[model samples]
Target: MKRIICILSMLLCMAAETVMAARAPVSEATEECLGCHSSIHPGIVEEWQNSRHARITPREALGVTGLARKVSARTVPDYLLPTAVGCAECHTLNAKVHADTFEHNGVSIHLAVSPRDCATCHTEEAVRYSGNLMAHARKNLAANPLYQDLQQQILGRPVRREGKLTFEPPAAETRQSGCFYCHGTRLEVVGMETRDTVLGEMEFPRLSGWPNQGVGRVNTDGSLGSCAACHTRHAFSIEMARKPHTCRECHVGPDVPAYKVYASSKHGNIYAAMNRQWDFSAVPWTVGKDFTAPTCATCHISLVVNTDGQVLARRTHEMSGRLAWRIFGLIYAHPHPMNPDTTRIRNKSGQPLPTDFDGTYAAEYLIDAGEQVRRTETMQAICLGCHSASWVRGHWKRFERTIRETRSDIRAATGIMADIWARGFAKGPDSDDSPFNEAIERTWCDAWLFYANTVRFSAAMAGGGDYSVFADGRYQLSRRIQELNDWLELRNQLFPPTPPIALRGLPEKPYRVQ
Candidate 1:
């Protein structure tokens, strides 16, 4: 009996050891990332360098910044916090963490310290992060139209040939300094290359890996994505990711007016009004539990109970749970997964799993606007707390039309651009990073991706009244596409002889859609 008990204890010890080895402990990728990028985007990297995230791990700085200051749950280990955050906290390459060194590409690397890893710095940030959309936004926002169309436009020429509108996928630009910087950049192995300005003016380190802001990056290991972009790192505080300020990074400017439109809308007014009331540190955020706050995550990633029922805090990585229809304009979803009916989920055994949301938040992700309609219906659900649903929806519907119409115009402009090229009125394709190309890229952004969306959203949010007084309609996007058209006209005129005409409608030609 004694011998048998000893044997059982030995077996238990071995099993524990096996379990421990199977899971990755925190890896130090963030530190290595900071080492280089700090030299690049210094203005943004500096604050973080001094941040505890730079010194230790991301969790060190969680509650020390942004809306996290409002969490009201500081332990004795609190310090002054910076309201602003930068790339290193989330997009690092590697460091020594989890008592082990991981690998990137062929390089020995570390694990990406995630929200749990971040708890060390800002305990409150981690608490709030556990329940926010940004926490798992990568899982949720995959099918977002805004992100989807941008990638599609760059990779293909939009055309309506034979009364058939097909999406033709051009060869992928496949690197940074393209549509990827803003959307999200995937990290792959850094080969033994010397220099190439095209790879973000810096080489992929021979050491750590790379991660971009893409809503959901498809990793080289054939897995899904990291959730740090909007959530940031270490101190993945809900306050920081929930603030319109956070969304502004990608949503502002000429193409995506998310911040500007929200600012002018009554929704924005409420956000500003309740910024103080909106508890940034509540876990499993069920609307009433966290001061009735609603940010981007609320509409797409959060679950809210009715006013009459007891609202509890509950969050999910599955963002599509409430969504119904898909408006991913060009491709099936962002980056066009060769299969729509399937999802790429890998298991611990490293095998491709079925279309499941076990570790995936895709199921709950917003295919449309209503599945989580306890508060209200339509996209206006997030805003109806302050604005009337009808008023909010009416304005936003027009906004949606603008988004649709402008995308159509972008398709039209691409067709025209194609005509010029097909007619032999232009030269070889320019480098994707050239200033001229960048300008053209900006124009494309205005046409469908950014400015057009911004104008419509801003107008709708402001409710077409005082706040929207200065907002322009689709004119913001219309002008850019038209400008591209005009530029093409001149570009074609200056060119020499042409080959036979075979108008493909769009440049690369559209494909069959289901």
Candidate 2:
């Protein structure tokens, strides 16, 4: 027994030495960074120490072949290939191009690390993500005037004025904390600020959008998207990125309740119950082997394989690469946009919406039928990893039916809103008043934005429980439509009718006095 115990101890010591040897040497610059940070910010250092970046060099990563390969760059600069990815590796890369670059402890370093720097070793992922809608999230939301109005209605401060609620443009801090929290903020170096640090007074760039990790963050290097949004900072752990909790940070809102719907799903239930037994770090993540259930990454981005090691789906950084429909409708569900920059799209009414108020799509800006079919097949392939063809087909049939039914519901609500606007009961698009500001108009918006969105998510994810019936689903949808009709009736009864306003190129009011 004593001889066996000694042998086991010797083996463990050898294993520890092997692990230490496998870790690529940290560069001299990174060593300097760690000299101070390892003590000053011990937590950050510890997390990074446990990351894959701490263990492997670009040279070793690039040598890996097949679907298991993580690094997509074919060749890395000689200077970078020899070192483990560390503070200096990422923060010092392309320093000349970064406007926020500043001398930090005698070394040039940028506060915000952009995708452009990461593209040094992840060329394919960076290029692919550049085409994802998430990469253009800030521009898609902020640049579009129509969306700006909607944002104002949702985030603006409300005050009662002249017996009605009027909204003030939200403060910059308000926007930073609200919608921009997920959509990302445009970061810029406003000026320099001096701070007392462990090493005494140090001058650092004061970034306007500091501390943001939103998916579409505009970095100081003019790069779109923040890889840290998923991979996380310091550690950049693949295990954390593969977990649904990372996605839950941004997708838990009522407007886009992907996480909420997923939490209620059978897949989510299985994940919640058995996730501890799963292998989140496995490359070519095998369905039913690595994970018995899907996380957000599993269905959207992860490279998946079958039990027999056959490739099921290729890894993707373009989150919407397999999506046929953009279920998060502005007014109604429509096909996915052709370009990631949805700001370039305009409807017939000259609105920067994929679909007009009446449900006509901006066809030229959206993906064509063939593209949609291809994307649908791609998504269906992922489904087939766990489900039979008949089951997958049936699920899609229900989802398609839900989209059609919800569109009809929204059309009904929009027609009611148009009637209210025509009768001059509320301000509208033609009258220079925000269409989303009024109480009734907000209710109309809820029909599509909240309730319809929840229903679609529930159907699409096959998590058809209260989410599809009660929790911001069909019940709320039916009640919201009824409430809009009631609101218009109440408004008519409360006030004297004036002559209808000029049609403003809209159709005649759909109702008249008896």
Q: Write the per-residue lDDT of candidate 2 for residues 1-514, one digit (tens) a residue.
A: 9999999999999998987787789999999999999999999998898789999999889899988899998899999998899999999999999999999888999989999999999999999999999999988888887777788877889988889777778988888898788889999999999999979999999999777888888988899999999999888878999998999999985888899989999989999999999999999899998999899998899999999998888999999999999999788999999999998988887777898878889999999999999999998898899999999999999999999999999988888888888778787775666778788888988899999999999999987677889988999999999999998889878864655445343432221111
Alpha-carbon deviation at 9 in model 1, angstroms: 52
For model 2, the superposed segments whose C-alpha errors exceed 4 Å read: 1-19, 161-164, 493-514
CA lDDT, every prediction?
0.45, 0.88
Candidate 2 lDDT score at position 367? 95
Clash list (residue pairs), candidate 2: none
Runs of candidate 1 exceeding 4 Å displacement: 1-111, 114-206, 210-223, 283-293, 310-314, 320-389, 392-396, 427-446, 459-473, 484-504, 508-514
lDDT of 1 by residue, 1-514 (tens): 9999999999999998875453322334444555665676666555443342333322343335632233333442222232123343333322443222344433454334444433434355455444433333344333433334335545556688898544465444442435554544444544444455522432333322344645444444333334466666544455676677876776665444556667766567777887786676554454555655467666654444445443322343434333332322221111112223232432232223221111122332222233334322434554554457687767656655654554455566555555654554442122111111234544544444444444445543453443233354455546766787887767656753465445544322211112
Model 1 TM-score (2 dp): 0.48
Positional deviation of residue 168's Cα in model 2 after best superposition, in angstroms: 1.4
Evaluate residue 175 in candidate 1 and report its C-alpha lDDT on the 0 to 100 scale: 29
Tell me the lDDT of model 1 at 279.
71
Question: Model 2 reaches what TM-score against the true structure?
Answer: 0.94
lDDT of 1 at 236: 47
Q: Which candidate has the top score in lDDT?
A: 2
